[model samples]
Target: MILEKKVPELWTHLLMVAFAAVCVYVFLPSLLIIYKIIVTVILIVILSIDLVLIIRKKVNYLKLTRLALVNLSILLIIVCLIFYTTNFLVLTDANSLKSVLGGSTLMGKLLFLLICFLQPIVLPLPEAVTIPAGSAVLGSFNAAYLGYSGTISGIATMFLLARIGG
Candidate 1:
């Protein structure tokens, strides 16, 4: 009797697994690098748990997943645009208005870093913009530090949002 009830849920589980496998495959090189493997595994586990909850009808996983997917899609598009613009700037004039800003004063560099740090959490700017601007103005080490700070800030914001929302 219980087996009869669970059979359909089992099928749903299988389908979700297959769909997730396809998503992982399609995202392979980006997701499969040695450094990223752990993160990828964690994400897969989270998704799997969410799928189980969805199948059990214990949660509104669909709405959550849909929101995540939409946000991810937007981020991807912004990332691509940033990459394209960066490449274009590097390949084309290379001495345009942005390049001029790249050679800003020390105060300017600090200001730019602060903006980059805030933008991710507050404004949602493309990281590529912040990175190149940092590299050009602050050099590689400072740029890396600024980027790390921005990521930390973003993570903190996400945590706060999750805590509040949950």
Candidate 2:
């Protein structure tokens, strides 16, 4: 009985970790596309198995529904971002992106900052792409400062979102 109780708890934590890992993996540029896809698939499979085991072991329906909704929302957002980027964005090079972002105007800077700000929360852009471009356009110091602020704000927004969801 004790072991049974512990198993569910263990699976719950594992599921959370797997989900978090997958989310982190998706945005951070890995060495290769094939490796990324393979690892993500394994993590997702683990997550799905853990979810099934936890559900089978008996959990509250209300909590389950809330969890499902939050997961679904995140998946939807990621899918939409992928679709938008693939269909609308043409420039894949960092230098071109830097030129566009660095229009050498106040409005351009603000837009660049905004992109950095949303990168974590909504945009599925790798930091590699944004940071280098920002550095070239805004210089190292200004780019770092703006990027740091945007990242922090994005993190805070995610925290608020999790709180609201719960």
Candidate 3:
């Protein structure tokens, strides 16, 4: 019984690790296109399983909600990639992106947060463009904190709207 209860929790952590690993490859991109394509296919399959579980009511409501959110995030990522691959959004230089955040740490943090928060819904820009630039400006820790917080808030807002309207 305890093992059964712990399985989902373990799977959640593993999924997060898989997501992080795929995102990290965008930074150290050596033959990354091939690798990302492979991992993305795997992620898609994992997401499909989650969707089946959610639709079948195999998980509790909380887990269902989480699955929904993660699925939405992955869809957003695919949208961003589509824009990127089709050249709808220009790939500006990282220095330019950092300069846009300005010099001071506080201002840099706020601007990074704002950009990351708005990127998904408003701009359709990917973190590949923002996170590296933000890290160069605010250092790794601050950049990661602001980026994650802003992203979570944006995603939560999206999920709330879906919940309200669904």
TM-score of 3: 0.42
The order by descending TM-score is 2, 3, 1
lDDT of 3: 0.67
Residue-wise lDDT of candidate 2 within 1-166, one digit each (tens)?
5346656555565656555455545553433677556656655665565566556764343255346435744764585568557643643468777778766667757867887788788877788988888888888898898888998898888889989986
**Which of 2 and 3 is ahead in lDDT?**
3
lDDT of 1 by residue, 42-134 (tens): 446656766676567655454454454445445545655675566445522323424544655676566565666566566445666666766
Q: Write the per-residue lDDT of candidate 3 for residues 68-107, one digit (tens) a residue.
A: 4476456546755764565433335576777777667687
TM-score versus the correct structure, for each prediction? 0.34, 0.46, 0.42
Which residue pairs collide, candidate 1?
A: none
Deviating ranges (above 4 Å) for candidate 2:
1-88
The CA lDDT at 154 in model 2 is: 86
**Which residues of candidate 3, in runs, are more than 4 Å off?**
1-92
Candidate 2 backbone clash number: 0
Of 2 and 3, which scores higher on TM-score?
A: 2
